[model samples]
Target: EAAKVRLADGQGREIACDGVLLTGQFTPESSLGRQSHLQLDSGSDGPKIDQYGRCSDPAYFAAGNLLRPIETAGWSYREGRRIGSLMALALCNQLPAPHDALTLKYAAPIKLGVPGRLVRGELAGLQHIQLRVSRAVSGTLRVRAQGLDLWSRPVSALPERRLLIPLKELQLPEHLDQLDICID
Candidate 1:
């Protein structure tokens, strides 16, 4: 609804405004997944899915909506298509075994990360690391590996909003394999 908002006082005149913004709390419906013994994402209140949407229970697979309730229809469709294709490949034993895949854990302020995990061998093509901030903050977000700074960026984060860290140019040293993102 785009309309003038009435002033708080008992006045007839409406306040001039471009538009009205309305919002409500959005709960990620993941209790069923959790009840079924799936790993719940600490950051998103959703299932912790792998790069291919596989849940902890090998018999189960979740993509798109079941993974992230706030996703758009187009994104959900893409996830389904991509994960379905990958599942088909796995059924035929065409997919290669993951080599030294590790989870992307975080410290305080960062609740969760998309791709919850990544293959160490896949770092060369790493593109994005998305997370939900615990609260609004204005500071430098840093990714540290083995207590050494690996990457950093200025961030203005809002709760529940996707905070993306682009990693297209990341160059990891051979000795340091694990990384953690924290607000500094």
Candidate 2:
């Protein structure tokens, strides 16, 4: 006898409904980046980027949620802006020429680091080597180059978060042959 629709049942009582609102969590749309074959972060659902937001492909760049599932709008905007500026520098030949890039691989539970590739002469700053773990761990975080131990430290890894690696303290060679990061 009523025109209103019932929303749901509560203890055998019907509740009135004004309208149905579809709500759900959002996810990052990284299909284009993935389709382009850019290196993806092991712990995240988006492309990996260097400090300047350059992807494995020097010609490509990513920032914000495109490089990770979640990030603040301000952070993303600043990142993109910085990357754009860097790109302009590169294009204008103001920055150093592109150098040989090294790739970092990880083992179980250790997700991929951002800027998966390290270009020669490029810096690995105190906060540049960010990592994410799938679960909690207590182990050695080892970084090696050319099969020689460069840096290692004990860490308490956590899930769904970023963990920074301090590479500047290692005093890596200006031109690296092979560089890697792992946990054991």
Candidate 3:
């Protein structure tokens, strides 16, 4: 038999409890991605993908919260629609392959960045870069590439909240090996 759990408030007063319910350490279901040998991001524990949602295997594609878990259903639906269209284009040979894509990395408080990489010519179509933080922070979020500051903005971020950095405002160089995002 399991030991009975006691309930209590901040006042140190005990409250009666018949049973305890536990839930909510949700994670992405990525067993398939793993079995397929897809590269996974250490931070998100999801498949690494490019802007078009293409995984390391050109034949495979991933989208929605599968790329980064725990987004609103609506956000997932929207992402599905967008990436679905790209997938369709790919099937029709209408989508161009990414030849100049660069990886986007993060450190410390930053949990993950969606799309995982930056695709050269596709930057014009990218509206924003979605960022998830590992903890609550209040500071300037900065993006740098090749020792050059690309973008920075003051932000107060919580682990549960998603941050958006407008891509249009950033003047990223024509060629970059990697882009880094962090709170400074």
The number of the candidate with the highest lDDT is 3
Off by over 4 Å in 1: 1-23, 96-99, 121-127, 167-178
Q: Which 10 consecutive residues of model 1 have the lowest summed lDDT?
A: 118-127
Residue-level lDDT tens digits of model 3 in 1-184: 2434444643443346665567464567787887778889777888988777888876888877787778889988888887888788888876656666788898789988877876766423336788888789999999998767889999999985889988777776876779998898
Worst 10 residues of 3 by lDDT: 1-10
Query: Considering TM-score, which of the candidate structures 2 and 3 is the better prediction for this target?
Result: 3
Full-model lDDT for every candidate: 0.67, 0.65, 0.78
Q: lDDT tens digits, residues 68-146, model 1?
A: 5576678668768877886776677554444444566777687667666554444132246767776788888887777
Candidate 2 lDDT at 14 equals 39
- Scored by TM-score, the top model is 3
lDDT of 2 at 86: 79
Off by over 4 Å in 2: 1-28, 37-45, 72-78, 122-127
